[model samples]
Target: METQRNTQSETKKSPQTQPHQENLKGTFAAVIIVGLIILLSWFGIFGLFLERA
Candidate 1:
């Protein structure tokens, strides 16, 4: 019974790493969004592929 309790406690402690994974996923999404905004702004300013008169 004591060993069972110890195993359960150890298993519970290992789950703390899950939040770090979630944080990385969120940060990655933020980076992609910012990058797309910058790219679209560049295209808008330069007017790439516009019809040349």
Candidate 2:
């Protein structure tokens, strides 16, 4: 009975000891897209100002 309990506790702890892997490709792509949009908007406004000046 004690050995069974130890085995059960070890099994539970095993998963927590391992690192969790995540896929960040979508997250990276989203950040890049947002950055590009902000950059483009800034450049477009700057260009318009230059043209008017």
Candidate 3:
């Protein structure tokens, strides 16, 4: 009976951990998108400068 009660509380802990994982996933995706935009803009500007030269 005691073991069953302990297992129930352990199962409840999973919900608390899940939100942090979701937030980290969202943050990682945002960083990747922003980095790509900056890189693309840098390349575009460089291309225009090269064309003029």
Candidate 4:
């Protein structure tokens, strides 16, 4: 029972790494979104294509 309590306490403390991980995740997501927008625009302005078609 004592070992079980210690294990639980250690697990709870590991959450300190989560904020740094979340920031990295946000940065990665932003990069991907911007890249996709640039690619789509370069393919030829999508709205103008639709208007002319």
Candidate 5:
């Protein structure tokens, strides 16, 4: 009975972290997308100028 109560308490602590982990994933993806857009624009502008030159 004592061990069972302890196990239940540990499981309850774990779910509190699930929402924070999901927010981190969302933020990470947003940063990646913005970085890709910046990189693509940099290359695109330079590519056209180089071809014309």
Candidate 6:
């Protein structure tokens, strides 16, 4: 039981020992693209409403 606990603790600590180096360039670009799409769709709907009114 003690050895099992030690191995479990080691595994838990192993992940934390590594520095977080995540590449988020694609994520940032995707977010920007989604935001722009939402904004453009909103403006387009507003334009249609104004034209019909």
Candidate 1, residues 1-53, lDDT tens digits: the string is 99999998888784444443344788889999999999999888678546342
lDDT (Cα, 0-100) at 12 in candidate 6: 79
Question: What do the candidate models score in CA lDDT, each in turn?
Answer: 0.80, 0.94, 0.88, 0.82, 0.88, 0.94
Q: Which candidate model has the greater TM-score, 3 or 6?
A: 6
Whole-model lDDT, candidate 4?
0.82
* Candidate 1 Cα lDDT to native: 0.80
- TM-score, every prediction: 0.47, 0.64, 0.57, 0.41, 0.55, 0.64
lDDT of 3 by residue, 1-53 (tens): 99999999898785444434344788889999999999999999999999999
Per-residue lDDT for 23 in model 3?
Answer: 48
Off by over 4 Å in 1: 1-22, 48-53
Q: Which residue pairs in model 1 clash with each other?
A: none
TM-score of candidate 4 relative to the true fold: 0.41
lDDT digits (tens) for residues 1-53 of candidate 4:
99999998888884445444334788889999999999988776877888899
Model 4 spans > 4 angstroms off:
1-22, 45-53
lDDT for each residue of candidate 6 in 1-53, tens digit (9 for 90 to 100): 99999998888784446678999999999999999999999999999999999
TM-score preference between candidates 2 and 5, better one: 2
Better of 1 and 4 by TM-score: 1
Candidate 6 residue runs with Cα over 4 Å from true position: 1-18
Better of 2 and 4 by lDDT: 2
lDDT of 4 at 47: 78
Task: Tell me the TM-score of model 3.
Answer: 0.57
